[model samples]
Target: MTPALSPAEVTINVVGALFAIPIVFGIFIKAPKLVVFGFIGILFCFSDSTWGQLETDANIYSRGVGMFYFSLLNLILMVAGVAALLKRLANPQGPQLAPPMAKYLAAFVFLLLGHVVVGLMQGIELDVILGYSGIFNVLNMMVFMYLVIMAFESEKDTQRLLLMIIALATLRAIFGAVRFFLFDGDTANPYRNFEGLDIKIFYFDINDNFVASLGAFCAAWLLTTPGVKLGWFKRGLLIAFLVLEVAAVALSFRRTSLIGLGLMFLFLFLRLPGTRKFMFSIVAAGLLAAVASVFYEHRLQFASEDDMLSSLIYDIAPSRGIKDGRFYELYAAAQSMDGNWLFGRGTWGTFSGDRERLSYHGDDFSFVHSGFGHVLLKTGIVGLLLFCGLLAAYVGFYMRHRNSLAGYARLLGDAGFAGFLFWVPTLLVGTPIIEFRTMMMLGLVLAMPFIAVGIRNYQVRAYQYDPRYAVA
Candidate 1:
């Protein structure tokens, strides 16, 4: 058995992310081509991998890298995007999504420099320059910002992105269903998980959380608007998708993601004004309660003697709450934190080169509970501060353009904010933050709605007011 990348998976990751580059660039500069690619990228994400699992130890099926993995595709896309950047030089004139944030972009650069300087002064080695992990994070951020820039190029481009996101969400839901019925939750094999590829194409591929997170993101988008494009077949698929995706989330047992998504939608339902939000909230809440009931019933049937949740519900049911059962795990993680409080060991991640010595999350682990924690582990307090500043810039810029798009813009903006805040549980979990797929997807989706703002302004000559800021 092979693992990770099937041929189609390779195409989706490579081609899909590559096209999203245009969506990013569109947010900054107008590029119709990016919209086409963005659709492709979104479609590719739906083509889950199957048949690439190889037996490592016991049930741990590991496979060689597949072509469709996001990281590998992004690398190829990066090269191509850069090459296209050359031709773009001729067009010289384009609109940017967040021109003012350029100031902050400068700030980010300065801060990175400062971190390096301080590290050197304090005799810290910057091996991140040579390490694949560090390099991946840096490049991933570039992809995030660039796609937002792509969307700013035009409103049509923004709409293109919206369509792509909606499509990806829909497809993911479909694939989730096909896999569930076809594989019977037997995600033990790659084919069982990814239904799009031949059973032979995929290697041990796992993207359960990736699917769930996006499912949440999509659900947020769909429920946010009135006329979200949903035909009966699509809507039915989405319904099925939601059920399977929610199941996947349960199966993943990704407590952090579930809690974060819950809080995010919670914020939206609470913060927004009017009946639409209110009614949607009621429906969503009721549906969620039902899902929770079923999930718990399932848990009861398969109750483990050593199950953590079971221990919490029964052993510490009265007073200890859920905290007592998992105190030791977190305490172990915190011990490492206290020792490396300041300049966290970024490269010294939980899922370092050693697979056997990893925590429950396995090889992909980063060991910092939250994304912020991951940042802390990587660059310490300094990195966290700089990273938050960059996010603030992203949020502020989106707010400025919110009115230019639909009500969905407001929802999308909140999603972006929530996505960032969503990492809080992870901070508590203190898991490794190297999950590259989530970052890329979050960047692309968040930027899509905001890029619409820039695109709208670009088309109607609204940007003409700022002659100096026009893409030159």
Candidate 2:
């Protein structure tokens, strides 16, 4: 049975609500676009484990504090969304929605709802699926994306959003750097649990790497792009942030994140616009290499005394092959196809019948680690196809419309492409699908094409009326 909250807990809950409600109101009323940046910021900066640990440390272990925080955040978002909708209804001049993107988002939401029904039919407890399957999280992401598109129609708004991303990523990088020195012992093993200030904030080092790397990629985009004015101070800040982000990835000591970061830079190198921009890329590469060299010894020691670059090559080289949980997860997914191949198992369902059972709201199941395996196991072949189809559609759409994007939209599209490139390969070894940042990255890619087109059309109409006025 669930326990009731104590007096202290009740006061905490009430205070949380009071603080959250005003913030939500202010966001919707004063600056709706800020909501997008705030959501991404919180997700990148904090995680469920952080929340859980805080609750445990507070002597309130009946439930996690993270859940309450998340619920409050969600409530804030919902209230903001409702206010936006109502304002639009009351005033016809409100921001317009993208019909095509809306349809796609709606279809995705329907698929998620269908999966919930499938989970229920498979005898998975509704609460268990709700808690773990992440349906709400996915829905919230979709809504956030839609709202971003509506709220951020101008190039200035997009630039502000990107700046917000860079600032948060800088914070993450500094946090990681501090933790690297303070918690260096935990760097010996990638999988071991290490409690530190940074780990408590993000739950894992890979996340720190992921967030910072993407921010660096976007910053690189803005810095290298043609006609974007930047004073020396701003340019120095961007370069410094990029270098720090690269250093943070090295400090993560996670081979997958480092590999992902490398691949993202390669994509950026190729996607850069022209000779001048490519020249800038050369300089950026040199700076990053210099930063990596500064930490070479630490990274080498972290990776079993092998040089960091050499270790990367040796690990990913085909001769190393697949081991660890990757092989086990793939084998488990393949072996689970006997009885229920169509809808293999519900959320929290697993193939490991022999494994010891752990209780989650009175339900027990094993977890598939790989993203592909998770989809195949939880929703089966049909659901896997749907998920894959959505991804393919987004990729196809992005590729088709990539060249037409202008200004900040083009830069964002490049970042999205680089992110997708990095995330796709990591799925073989990790469950990128269940991750909030990965989904948000995909949301950006999915929404960017339409947002780009909208910006272009708006510019064209404005230019037709007044050619002397510049449009961005």
The lDDT leader among the candidates is: 2
Q: List the residue pairs that clash in candidate 2.
A: none
Model 2 C-alpha lDDT per residue in residues 1-472, reported as the tens digit of each score: 2346688877887787788777777777667767766766676775332322222323211233344534455566667767666756777775456554455556655766676787788776665665434434455556666666766777676667667777787786776667666654333232343323233122243455677778888877767777789999999988888777776666555556666776877777777666865687777678657656644554444443566665545534455554322354456457776776675565555665324221211233344556677777766776577667666766777777777877877776777667666666566666555554455555654565556666676677778999886585
TM-score of each: 0.64, 0.76
Model 1 C-alpha lDDT per residue in residues 358-413, reported as the tens digit of each score:
33344444443456656665566666676677667666766666555554444445
Q: What lDDT would each prediction earn against the true structure? A: 0.50, 0.61
C-alpha RMSD of candidate 1: 8.3
Off by over 4 Å in 1: 1-71, 80-93, 99-135, 186-253, 300-342, 346-366, 399-404, 407-432, 459-472
